[model samples]
Target: MTVKTTLSFTDRHHRFLTDKVGQGVFASQSAAVAAALEQMIRDEEERELTLGAMADEIRARLDTPRADYVPGENAFATARARLQAAREA
Candidate 1:
C-alpha cells in the first residue's frame, strides 16, 4: 500500500475544503484538495485561452498583413522591417 502525505491550506481555504468534505462532495480532505487543484488548473487553462484570444483580437485590429507577420523579438518593428527588407530583397 502507498502511504500519503498531507498538505495544509490557509485558514479560510481550509475551512472551505473542510466544508466540502463535510457536505460529502469528497470523501476526505485529500479528495477535496485534489478537486480544488483540478478546478484551479481548469480555470488557469481557460484564462490562458481567453488571454490568447484577446491578444489575437488586438493583433487583428492592428491589421497586420500576412507576409509582414514576423514573430521575432520586438514584434512591431521587426515585422515591419522584415517586410520592407523582403520587398527590397
Candidate 2:
C-alpha cells in the first residue's frame, strides 16, 4: 500500500535527493526518500538490539559473585604489562 503525503526538506537535502535521482541511484525523489527512511529504520533497529545486548551483559556482570570479580587496579596493571610486552615484541 502506498500513501501520499507532502514533505518539506531543506535546500541541502533537496539537492542531495535530486542529485541521487539524477545519477540513477534511485528511480525518483520519492524513491530516494523512501530508501533513506528504510536505512534510518534499520539503523534504529540495530541500535535497539545493541542496547539490549549491553543491558544483558550488565545484568550478567552484576549477578557474578564478588569473589569472581577482578580488582580494577590489578586488571589495569595486567593490561598495561601486556601492552608493553606487545610493543617490545
Candidate 2 lDDT by residue in tens digits, 49-75:
999999999999999999999888887
Residue by residue across 1-89, what tens digits does model 1's lDDT show? 64698776799988988898899889988887777779999999999999999999998968977778666666688678999999999
Model 1 clashing residue pairs (backbone): none
TM-score of 1: 0.57
Per-model TM values vs. the true structure:
0.57, 0.88
Worst 10 residues of 2 by lDDT: 70-79
RMSD to the hidden true structure, all candidates: 13.2, 1.5
Q: lDDT of each model, Cα atoms only?
A: 0.85, 0.95
Residue-level lDDT for 68 in candidate 1? 83
What is candidate 1's CA lDDT for residue 9? 77
**CA shift at 79, candidate 2, in angstroms?**
3.6
